[model samples]
Target: MGAEGWRWQDSWIFVSLVIAGGAGRHRRSAATRRPEGIRLTDVLATADHLNRSIPERDDVLGAVRRLAGAGLVTVTDGWFRVTTAGEQLWRSRPSSGMGTTVDTVQKLLNRRCQPGDTDWTLDEDEYGIAVQEYIVRLLPRPRRSPETAQERAEPS
Candidate 1:
């Protein structure tokens, strides 16, 4: 994959798929870990081998959005599955030299948008805004309201 079209997170997801043997979803519990499936976190962990840092939640969401936008995959019930086109793109990738790039992303899409196994997919823009909101939620809490602060300062 080239190093321009995709955000880094997208490459991580694709490479994770390649590494995980086409497992679409990550197993949540170690006890549930299967030979076929891998954890999402482990995807990031796998990226580490490529010298790519694991993405934060927002980046992961963005990657998923990009994939969905291209109809390469679908996100449903909190899982992602590659479509037939996604599979082709995955297969087309060189055995070595993976990078994040628009070209790479396009290669993943391969100008094909196929129906996926998932029941749902998100609109890229809406999903992006939603993920931004989620990131805001993750930020540290703001200072207490003036009234609450005053009351607390006054007495128990």
Candidate 2:
């Protein structure tokens, strides 16, 4: 299965994985957090890190865009920063609930879309994205199952 669907999350160290090991390293608290904006190499690095058997760069990009669009991230020239919004979103989530599919979509999105040359204000189009962003935030798949094994186990 691609990174797009539900998969086993190493529940033992879920927090570290969810934030891509960047959350705690960058912050003392949510208020004090600053998400480094997008760096091409960084996104590529993350893409490589998440590059599983399935080519789900699209999914990963979706995740980044959601985070960035939601005010969770601030993408500047060559650097990506996660803002307070991001820390809050990541931290507020339950450590052990099934992650959301919306998150999977966002991840893919992030993997694909690079940050614009300058900082962007989230607009109406982005608002639509934010809706997905919020849903994805509410639930992050890959971090947890988006669906059940039974769903996949059964043949169509």
Candidate 3:
């Protein structure tokens, strides 16, 4: 998987959409054989909460478009559902390395975004900051500790 091609936020938003789809209740719609997929609003709301980024509709839509192109999700009207490939993607756990951002995000997602889950009691502001920090840590740049920054500033 060329996950490297995708921005961290885009990948996170895609997972958020998948979780939202799984959590949606199966409502029958006469026009479509499949059950009512998750609403775009709901998915966007979840992504905003998880990433604390409050991404523009276009941003989320772009991610959705990419996922659709990859056959990871199917969209109709304003609803979305995960395809078989999406399920596989979700099940493929990130490599487990202690203290790694990927592992932490994976654990958090599993704990809080399970299918059919409805219990979320986290403070919105705090959770948002937490999500933001987690995403920042996943960036490819070398992490610079505060002490290291201070030492660099203090020339010999």
What 10-residue stretch in candidate 3 is worst by lDDT? 113-122
lDDT of each structure? 0.51, 0.41, 0.55
> lDDT of candidate 2?
0.41
Can you write out model 1's per-residue Cα lDDT over 5-73, one digit (the tens) per residue? 565466666655445444323333324344334334444555455554445556555666666666665
Which model is ahead, 1 or 2, in terms of TM-score?
1
Model 3 error, position 153 (Å): 69
Please identify which of the two predictions, 2 or 3, would achieve the higher TM-score against the true structure. Answer: 3
Q: Which candidate is the best by TM-score?
A: 3
**Model 3 Cα lDDT, one tens digit per residue, 51-100:** 66566544555555555766666766546777766666655655443224
Candidate 3 wrongly placed segments (more than 4 Å): 1-4, 23-34, 95-156
Q: What CA root-mean-square deviation does each model show from the true structure?
A: 10.5, 17.4, 16.7
Task: Please identify model 1 stretches exceeding 4 Å from their true place.
Answer: 1-5, 21-38, 95-156
Q: Model 1, residue 30: displacement in angstroms?
A: 23
Residue 14 error for model 3, in Å?
1.1
Candidate 2 residues lying further than 4 Å off, grouped into runs, are 1-21, 25-38, 51-65, 97-156
TM-score of each: 0.46, 0.37, 0.50
Using lDDT as the yardstick, the better of models 1 and 3 is 3
Worst 10 residues of 1 by lDDT: 112-121
* RMSD in angstroms between candidate 2 and the native structure over all alpha carbons: 17.4
